[model samples]
Target: MSDPLRETDENVVPQGIDPLRATIRTRFRRGELARAYDWCLEGLKHYPDNLWLKHRAVLCLTRSGALERAQTAYAEFRLHEAHYDAECRALGARLLKSEALEAPLSDFTIQAVRAAEAYAAIYQETCSYYPAINAASLFVLGGQIERAQPYIQAVLEQSENAEQDDREGAYYLHASRAEAFLLRGDMQRAQASLEAAIALDPDNHAARSITLRQLRLLADHLTLDLTGFQALEPPRPAHFAGHLFAVGDGDNQMTALDEEALRVRVREALKTAGVGSLYGSLAAGADILVAEAAHDLGLPFHAVLPTPSRVFFETSVRPVSSDWSRRYDACLEHAASVQEVTSDRKQVGDLHLNYASRIAMGLARIQAAALCTRPLQILLWDGQDNQADRGTAHDARLWRLSGGEQVHLDVPSRVRYRGAGNEGETADTPHFSQSLRAMLFLDVMGSSSVPDDRVPVFVDAVLGRLARACEQFAPGLVYQDSWGDGLFLAFESVARAAEAAVTLRSEFEAIDFEALDLPASLALRIGGHFGPVHEGRDPIQRRQSLFGSQVVTAARIEPMTLPGSIYVSESFAALLALEAEKAYRCEYVGRLKIDSQKQRQPIYSLRRLRRPETSN
Candidate 1:
C-alpha cells in the first residue's frame, strides 16, 4: 500500500476528475482544517465509498472544534467499515477524548476514563504505541495516575522497538518516550526526550503545537515545570508593510538598484527574525519584494488584497510598472492563500487599503497564536510621518500601540516618495471626507412572537437590558438607534464594537425569562463590519447617523447571523486583530450569503479571549 500522506499527481488520475485525496491532504497539512473539511465533503460526493476520505473527514471535523458533528460523522463512518481496525478504533477513541476535554467539570473525569479504557483496549489488541501513549495520557487526565503506569511502560517498550527511519515516525517515538517518562515522574529523562523530539523536526509546526498542548495539559495536571519547553514552539509569524512606489514621479520613482537593495534588506530581516510564515499585501515595491524574498526562503506567504485581483493589480501593481505587475502576479500565483478584504472594484480613498493592511496584521497574529508564538511586524519605512492616516507610518504606529515586536528597515535616502497618486499634496492636505468606523446591527430573535399583552414585558426585559449594555460603551459608541426589534449602533473602533457585541451577547444570555414572563427562546443576533461610512444627520430622526455601503453591509450580515452569537465580516475581524490583539478571537464560520444577490461573504464568529491560568 502507498503512503496516504504522500502527495498525489493529478495527471496520473483520469481526466475530468479531481485528485480529491491529494487536495484534502494538502489543505490538512497546511493547517487549513476548515477548507480541508470542505474538500472532504466534496470528495465524498464523487466517491462515497472512499474510506480514506471518510476517515479524514472525521479527523478534520474533530480538529476544527465541531465535536458534535464529528461524533455523528464518525458513527456513520464506522457503519460503512467492514471491520474495526486499529485506525478506526483509534479515531473513535480520539472523538471520545475530545468530548471529554470539552465536557463540563462534573463529567470530565468520567468521560476521560471511558475514553482511556477504549484506548487501552485498542493498545492491548494491536500493541500499537500510538494508542498506548494516548491511553496513558488520558488515564492521567482522568485522575488515575496509578492506572496510567502500565500503559506508559507499554508505550516505552513498544517505542523502543519501533522503526526510526521516517522523520515523522522518529519524532513521534521521541515524543511518546517523553510522555511515558513524564507519566513515570522522571522529569530529567522526559526533558531530554522532548529536546530530541524537537531537534528531530524543528519545522514541524503543527506537530510541535500538538506536543505543546499535551505538555501544557501535563504541566497543569501533574504539576510539572514547563519553563524549558517554552523555546520549542514554532518561529514567529511576520506581518510585512511598506511604502508603494510612485511610478510616474521621476524624482521619487524607485530605481532598479533601490529595489534590489530593499529586497536584500527584507530577506535579511526575515532570516534574522526567524519568520516561519508571512502575511501581507501584493502591492508593488516593498510588498512584492517581501513576498518574493519569503518565497525564496521557502516560507509560506498569504496575500490579503484590498480589492478584487484585477482591480488591485490595475491600480496598485500595473500602474507602478509592467515589471512590477509581473512580479505581483508571480507572488500571487505562488501565495499559499489569497483573501480579498472587499469585492468592490472601486477604491474608496485609502479606506480599503488601510482595512486590508489591518486584516493582514490580524491574520499574522492568528497564525502565530495557532503555532504557539508571537507575531512580528516588519516595516520597510522611510521613517517619515505623512498626513495620510494609511501607510507604513500608520502601520508602525498601530504595531507599537498594540505592544507587538517590530523591525524597521529604513528606505534608501535617494528614493523619497509621496502617497500613491496624491503627488502634489502637502502635510496640510485635507483628509478624506469618509472616516473608517465600526457598524453593528442586532435583532431580537423571538420579538415577533410576543403577544399584545406581553409587548411591554418584552420591551422592558429585552430592549431595556440592551440599552444598559450600550451605556457601558458610551464613550466608544458614536451613534445608536432602535426600530421595533432591530437595533443599530456605530462605534469609533473595531475593538470597541467587538467588546460591546460580546457584552451584549453575554448579558442577553444571562437574562431570566422566567421571572420576566418572557419566552426562553428570546435571544440576540448581531453582525458587525468595519469600513469607511458617511457620517451625517438623519432628516427623519433629526439625529446624527451613519449611512453608506458599509452600513448596509453591516445590516445584511445580521440576518445571516445565528442567534445568541455574534458574526462579523472579514474586515471587522481584521480590524479587531489590529486594535485588540489578545482581547478577542475570530473563528471563520465559512462564507455566508448576506444579501439577495446570492453573493457570499466570509463571516467569523466573535468571542472574547480567556487568558489561561498559570500552573502552580
Candidate 2:
C-alpha cells in the first residue's frame, strides 16, 4: 500500500485525515482563524495520531468559541504519554486553571507524573549538558515551585542533550525557578531567571506574566521605578481596561480652520502616529468635521453622540460607541424615534455647556443601562487625570451612574488642549486655539443599484480606503454613518471640508475600480456644505437634524452634479472669500429652492477646474 501519510504531499494530507492541521498552519501564519477552524475540524478526523494536528485543533477551537470541544480534546491529548508530554501537561494545567476546574483528574495527574518521569529518565544519562532542566512548570502551576528546583537543576545539567527548541522547556523550568526565587524573596535570581527566559522567547506569555506579577509584588514592598527598574514589561491589553477614560471638554473651537489648516493638522497627526484610531467626542465642535473626515476617508466610526429623547441617530453605518463593553464595535440600539416628512425635522439643536462632557456622560449611562438589561463585560473609561487638585479629581462618581466599573486610565492622564500652555510649560501643549466653523454632509447620489448581499464587503472596502485617506490627511477628526453609500460629515472649516471633498473625489476616481466590480467609467458623486449649526442631537426634534437651508442646498448639489465631482454650497464659498476664488473656479449655477422653502434659492457651483466643458 502507498504510504497513507505520504499519499498526499508531505505538506498535504489525504482525505479522512486532519486537513484542519494543514489549514491551521497556513491560517495561523496568515492570521485567519475562522477559515482555519473550518478546515481544522476536517483534518482532526483523519489524523488523530498527529500531535501537531491535535494541538492546532485545540487552539483554533478554543479561539473560535468551541471551548467544550477544546477542553475535551485537551483531556484526550493528555492521556497519551507523547514526546511533548511536558509541554502538553503545562497547556492542560493552564486550560484547567482558566476554566476553574474544581476536581483534579487522576488521568491528568498521572500523565503529568509519567511525563516528568520520562524527562528525568532521559536527564540522568545526558553527558553533553552542564545543567539539567525538568518538569518545573508542574510545580509552578501546582503552587510549589520551591519543591521543583531539584528537578529543574537536573534538567538544566543535561540541557545540552536537548535541542534548541527545548529552550521553552528550559524557560518553563526557569518560570518555576523564578517563582521559587520569589518565594524565598531572592529578588536578584528571580529577576535574572525571568530575564534569561525572556531572552529565549520574547513573546513568552508565561514568563512575561510572572515577571510583571513579580515586579508588582516588588513595587508593593519597595519603591517603584527605582534605579534598576525598566518599565514593568510593556503594558498588556488586560492592563488598559478599567484604567483609562475618554475625556474631552466641549471645545467648539475650530471656526477659523481653513481647508489647508484642516489638512495640515490631520496630515501631521497621522505622520506622527502611523495608524491610530480616533475616538472623537460628538459634543465637541469638531464632531461634524471629524465625521466628514471619516466619510471622506471611508473609515468605520464609533459614534458616541447622544440623541434627544431615545431616537437613534440615523446614519449609513451602524454607529458604535464605547458603550456596553470595549468590544461593542457596532451599534446596538434600534430605532427609537425617526423623524419623518410631514413632521418638521431639525438636525442641530441648542449649544449647551459641557456638551461634549454631557455626551460622554450619556454614553457611559447608555452602556450602564444596557449592562443592567443584559450582563456583559465591564466597561472602562479611556482618558484620565493625574493631578489630584485639578478640580477634575477623576470623576469616580460617573461610574455609579453608568452602573459599571470605571475603565482604568493607564495612558497618562493629561488634559487634551488645542491651544497654548502656560509659560515655561512643556512644548507638548501648543499655544494655538481653534474655533469651530462649518459642518459638511455627504450623501451617495444613487445607491439603489448596489447589491444588498455584497454591501458590507463593498462598504468595508470603500470605507477602509477612505480611512486611509484620513490617515494621509486628517488624523483625529472623522466620523462614519451607517448608510451603505450615504455619509454625513462635519468639518472645522469649509475650506478643509472642500479640500477633503476634492481629495475624496480624486481618490474615489483613482480607486481600485476592479475591486468594486464596477465598469471603468464608474465613479462617485460627492456633496458638501458649510454652515453655523448646532453640532449635537436636537432635543426638541428628538435627535432629528435641524440643518438650515445650507444642508438642503448642499444635498441638491450632488443630484445636479456629475460622478467623481465635489459640490460645495455658496455659503461655504463666501467663507472662503478671495481664498475660494484662488483655489476653485466659482460660477453662478442660477437659483434653486431647497427642502423647507417655497421661494427659489440662489446657488453657486465651485469647481476646481475652470471650464465646465473640460470637467465633462
Candidate 3:
C-alpha cells in the first residue's frame, strides 16, 4: 500500500502564498486575528485549494469568536469542525437567546424552530445522542413543550437501559427536561432539573447557558440550586491500576538499532512502573513500540486511532515497513479499548497532528481519571526543540513541564538529521515548546503584609493547603512555583482548576480566624486564564516554569481581583462559557487594559459558593 502520509519529494509552494503566508504567521502570533484572517482569506482567493491558508483562516475565525464562520471554513477545507460538534452548539446558541426564549413568537424563535427541525432530521439519520438533545431542547426553546416530552422521555429510557460506561448522553437529557419545565413556567422543577443537568456534566455548554440565563433573570427571586448541585455526586474520575500515556519521536527520526533500544526501554519502563494498561496512539514509532511491549507483557492497550483503519494503515502504519503494519494491525485487533477519534486527516497535516496529540494525551488523562488515577507518562525524544511544529520533542517537554512524571529516554538518531547531504548533526535549541495551559495565580489576601514571623508560617499553611486540595482533585495542577504570598499553577482543563479554586476558597472560609490569632479572615484572590505558554526552565530560579503573554496576563488579573473571589480574563471566561455546566458560574465585571496592553479586554468574576439566597 502506498504511504499516504509520505510527503511529496517534489517541494513546490502553492502559487502566490509565500509572502502572504509569512505575513499571516507573523500577524497570527501577534494576536492580530482579524488582520491575519483577512490576509489568509485573500490568499485563499488566489489559491482556493491552499490547505495552509484555509487552516490558518479557520483558526483565526475561531479565536475571534466567529464560530459559525469557522465551521463553514472547516467544512470547505474537509476538516473536522475543529470544535466538538459545533453545528449543534451553533444551533443551540441561536435558539437559546434571551429574547428568543422569552417570546415564542419572536422572529428568532421562528428561525430556531426551523433549526430544531433540521437537527431532528439529523438525529433521524444519524441516531447519535448529540442531535437528539438538540431536537428536544429546540422544541422547548420554540415553545413546543409538548413536542419535547417524547424526546426527553425517550432519552431517559435509553439511559436507564444503557451500560454504565455508555451513559454519557444522560446529562443532555436532564438539561432538556430543565428546558421543558422552564418553558412550562415550572420554575422550581426547572431549577432542580437544571441543577441535575449541570451536576451530571460540567462541560455541557448548552446546559450551562440555560442555567446562566435563569440566574440572570431570576437571581433576586430564584436562588440557584447550588445545594442540590453539590449534593449530586461528582463525575467519577477514571482510574486503572498501572496505566500510563506514551509519546515520542517518529519513525524517520529513529534508526533500526535505536528502535530496538527504544522498544526495550519502553518494555522496561512499563514493567518497572508496574503499568498494566498503556494508552496512546498507534503511530509507527514510539507509540507502536510501547504498544508492542504492552502486548507482549499482557498490558491492556487503549488505542486512539486518529483516522480510519485503512487510512491510518496506509498513511501512518504502513509507511515504515510491513513489519510495522502487521504489528499495528495486531495491536488494533487485540486492544482492550479503542477510540476512533476522527477520519479527516489527509496527510497528517499540522492541524490534524495537533488534534491527534490532544486526543492521545487527553485520553490518557481523562480515561485514567475515569477508570483509575491519572496515568503516568513515558516520553521518548531526542533533545531537539522543534519550533516548526508540535511533535515528540514538544510533547515530552510539555508532559514533564506539566508535572507529569515520565521515564524519558534520550535517543541519538532523533536528535538531528544526518542523512542526505547533511553535515554532522546538531539538534535544535534545547527549549521546550509552548502549549495551552490553564494558568492560575492565587495570593493570600494579606500574606505579604502580615507580621514577619507569621509571614513564613501563614504562607506555608496556605500553599500546603492549596497543594493538598489540588491532589484531591483528579489531574491535579502543575504547581510551577510559589512566592511568599502567591502560587502559580497550570492544568490540562479549566474545569478542574476552577473547581480546585472554588473548593480551596470554601475550605479556607471554614477555618476560624480567631483560632489562628488573626485580626481578619483569610481569603484568596485568584486569577485564571488559558493561553499558550513556553514550558521551559526559568532563568532566575532555574526551575521548570510557564512563561508567555497568557501567564503574565493571569498574574495581572490576580491582584485586580476582590479578595475571596476568582477573577478571570476574557479568554478564561470564554473557556468557562464552553465548559461550566453550573449556574452563577461567572459574571462580567468590566474591561481592563491592564499594564501595557493596548486593548481593553473584558474580565469576569466567578462568584464564591454561598447559601442559596432567595430574597434580594
Worst 10 residues of 3 by lDDT: 235-244
Instruction: Tell me the tens digit of each residue's lDDT in model 1 across 186-206.
Output: 878888888898788765666
Give the Cα-based TM-score of candidate 3 against the true structure. Answer: 0.34
Model 1 TM-score on a 0 to 1 scale: 0.80
Per-candidate RMSD vs. true structure? 5.4, 24.9, 18.4
Query: Could you tell me how far off, in angstroms, the CA of residue 161 lies in candidate 1 after the best superposition?
Result: 1.3
How many clashes in each structure?
A: 0, 74, 13
Relative to the true structure, candidate 2 reaches a TM of 0.33
TM-score for each model: 0.80, 0.33, 0.34
**Model number with the top lDDT:** 1
- Rank by lDDT, highest first: 1, 3, 2
Task: Tell me, by TM-score, which candidate is best.
Answer: 1
lDDT string, candidate 3, 175-281, tens digits: 55564455445657767866766666654332343334333333332333433332232212111111112122554354566567767877787776655456667
lDDT of each residue in 1-616, candidate 2, tens digit only? 2322211232344454434444455544332333344445446566556666666656654433233445776777653456455445444544443232212343434444444444444445542121123334344334445655776555444432444556555655555455445544566776776677666765443334434543443334333332243322421110001221223333321223332354344434332322112222322122333333433443322343323212213221122222212222122211111111111132222221112222333322222111111111122222444542211123334323334333222222232222211112111224321223344445444455556775675576765566566555453244334355655666665656767777766666677746776444545766665443433444665553434444455566666554555545544544442233335543333234454554333344445632111100
Best of the two (1, 2) by TM-score: 1
Candidate 1 overall lDDT versus native: 0.76
